[model samples]
Target: MTTVIEVQNLTKRYKDKRALDNVSLSLEEGAIYGLLGRNGAGKTTLMSILTAQNFASSGEVRVFGEQPYENARVLDRVCFVRESQKYPDDAYPRHAFKAASLFFRNWDQGLADQLIEQFQLPMKQTIKKLSRGQLSAVGVIIGLASRADLTFFDEPYLGLDAVARQIFYDRLLEDYAEHPRTIILSSHLIDEVANLIEKVIVIDNGRILLDDDTDAVRDRAVTVVGDAEKVDAWASGREVLHRESLGRVASITVLGGVSADERAEITASGLDLAPVSLQQLIVRLTQKAESATKVIAVKEGVR
Candidate 1:
């Protein structure tokens, strides 16, 4: 596999707030990456920097083994679909597609036309007059039909209903299968894209929390559910990511993989182990990271 994008000690600061703090990661070609994070977690900042839409305060970034800033070679191969993309006031959906076709060498007009018809996007309406969902559809069409070597979709499903979102997901997977390329998707709906992405990159408070294959990430935590007392005893001294209790029953999610022997022990003890979904795991991990950050801040203040 070829390394398509590389970042080393990348930092983006706005005044006193650091949007990205010493973030370093690499993305391989022909893989879909889910960039997961909460609001204000710097997911957008990181993507903007990678696409060269925003400048980094310090450190290095390379796309296609070349700097992306003002480099036509890198820019031509990249496509970024922002959450709120701007277009000319008088331009319509067709005009947007036309511009994209001109810019991207691999642009497939057939696919674009098909998407437009499927999305029912009115070609006569000015971009600003279209509904939010329709506007989002335009971006999705461009992102998919452009067929750029590298593409970034930042919350591409906004304002889209469940059915429309599913359509977008299905089309994305279908297109990706036919044409494999590097794609970075930043979305708040974690479970929705869980099956679509090959890898997961989690960011929390401007820092990288987890970066690994989706399968490996799913194994990073396990939940135990049973009697409160029994579960507590079994989970004692373990790294608990989350815990919920109801009456005499308690469910505890703990970090780390369970061995076969451990699974047997858990079963013998009458405790049932449950698999944590990608969304659940990410939520727990980010919450835990937030709590740890608060603790460290308090400790430093005491010092």
Candidate 2:
């Protein structure tokens, strides 16, 4: 796998707020990545810096082995589909498509036409006149049809219904299989895109909290359900993220994976293992980090 993007000690600040802080990560070619977090997390800031749409206050960002800012060779290979993407007041859907075709060397007109029909887009209607969902469809169409080596879709499904979102996912997967490229999807819909992305990158409060393979990240935590006493004993000495007990039954979410031997031991001990959801794990992790920070601040105040 070739490295397509590299960020080292990247940080961005706006007055008193930090949008991205000491973040560094690498992305390889031909893989789907999920950029996930809460609304104010640094997902968008990170993406914007990588695509050269925004500047970082400190550190370095490289796409395709070169700085992306004002670099046409690098910019031409990248496509960023933002929910708030701007268009001329008089420009129609057709005009947007035409502009994209002119910019992207690998643009597929057939794919764009098919997506227009599937999304039921109005080519003649001005962009400002289209509904929110229709406008989202226009961006989705362009993102998929552009076929850029690196594409970023930042909440590109805004206002799209479940069925419409499903269409976007289906077409994206099909096309990706035929022509593999690096894709970074920044979405709040975690579970919906979980099965589609191979890796996950999470940010919280302007810092990177987690970055790992989707499956490996899932295995980082597990829940054990059974007798309270037995579950408590097994959970002892392990980092516990969450725990709940109802009568004699207890469900404990812990911060580690169970090995095969441990699995057999768990079954022998009359405990049941259940998988943790990505959304749940990430929420707990971020909450835990925030709690730790608060504790440190309180201790410093005492000093």
Candidate 3:
């Protein structure tokens, strides 16, 4: 598996704040990745820097083994689609698709046409006059049809309804199966794309919180439920992400996978294990980071 993008000790700061602080990660070719994080958690910042739309304040970044900044060879193979994608003042849907066709090396007119029809996009209307969902569809069509070797979609489903969003997903998966490439998707709709991504990279407060295979990430934590005392006993000394207690029963989510023996012990104790949703796990992790930051800030203020 060739490395498609690599960042080492990268930092991007704006005035007095750091958008990305010493972040590092490597993305392999032909893998779908979910770049998950809370709002203002550097997901967009990281993507912008990777695509050369923004520069890093320090450290290194390499795309396809070469720096991406002003590198047409590398840039042409990468396509970035975001909610705020802009076009010329008089541009129309056809204009955007035509331009994308000219830019992306592997541009497929047939795929673009298919998507436009499926999305029922109006070809003649000026882009500025199109509805929000239509605007999003333009980006989605370009992103999927461009077939760029590396693509980044930052909230590409912004104004799309459930059905349209599913269309995008279904088409993306279908095309990806026929033509495998690296794709980095950043979205607030975590559970929506949870099953689509092969790997997960979580960022929080300008730092890498978690990065691993999607399945392995799920196994990073487990939820146990039943008697409060038994649950506490089993979870004691472990990294607990969240816990809930009602009467004598408790539901505790703790870090680390349980072995078969551990499962047997849990069963013997009359405890039940439940699956944790990816969105829930990510929310808890980011919230935990936020709480810790507040605590540190409070301590510094006291000093």
Candidate 4:
């Protein structure tokens, strides 16, 4: 696959806080990538920098073999759909679509029109007067219709109901199959987008904690259910991502895939193996650090 983006030693800081620390990653063309992390884990910062909407405190960001900022050639090939995209107070949905069509060379008016209908958008209504969900629909339509070589959607489903979100996902997959492009989706709803992404990139506390193909990342963990004691015994010495106890039964997720032999062993131990949710894994990895900090604070207070 061709490399569309190459980031090296990327670091960003805001006063005393580090937004991104020594981060380096590459994006493969014609693939869907998931940029995941906690709310303040630099997902937005990284996307903004990559899209040329924000500057990095330190680091090199290359898109299409050139810096993206004001590089017309590269910037034109990119479309960024933010969760809360801002438009003029008097601008209506139709006006936004018109602007996008002019900016993106590959923009498809037909697709935009279809998506508008699919989302049931009210084009005549001013953007500021639309519901949050309707506003999201406008951005989704632009992102899909622009057909940019590289599209960045930073949590573009805000305020969308389950039905609307499902429609968005279905349309995204359908259009993507016909028109393959590099897509970077930054969303907090990891599980919802888990099946759609080809790869996963996770950040925590301004640092990339995990980067791998979605399957490979899933393989790093497995869920087990059975007697609490048996589950605990099996999880012992293995990285337990998440664990829950219900009465005498317990479900424990461990870090690593189980080979046939391991599976047999687990079965023999009277434990059942289940698929681990990507969201669960990411939440555990990103939140553990914060939990530790809280623990330290508690200990300090006690002292």
Cα TM-score per model: 0.98, 0.96, 0.97, 0.93
Predictions in order: lDDT: 0.95, 0.93, 0.92, 0.91
Backbone clashes counted, model 3: 0
Least lDDT summed over 10 consecutive residues: which range in candidate 2?
284-293
TM-score of 2: 0.96
- Pairs clashing in candidate 1? none
What tens-digit string does per-residue lDDT give for candidate 3 at 200-241?
999987999989999998888889999999899989999999
What clash count goes with each model? 0, 0, 0, 1
Candidate 4 wrong stretches, greater than 4 Å: 292-303
Write the candidate numbers in order of decreasing TM-score. 1, 3, 2, 4
Candidate 1 to truth, TM = 0.98
Report the Cα lDDT for candidate 4: 0.91
Candidate number with greatest TM-score: 1
- Assess the local accuracy of residue 74 in candidate 1 as a C-alpha lDDT between 0 and 100: 97
Report how far off residue 261 is in candidate 4 (Å): 1.1
Once fitted onto the true fold, the runs of candidate 3 whose alpha carbons sit more than 4 angstroms away are: none
Which candidate order results from sorting by lDDT in descending order? Answer: 1, 2, 3, 4
lDDT of 4 by residue, 1-303 (tens): 799999999998899988999999999999999999878889998998998999998989999999999999999999999976889999999899999999999899999988888889988789999999999999999999999999999898998899899999998999999999999999889989999999999988888888999989887888999999988988899977678898999998878778999999999988898986888888887766678768999999999
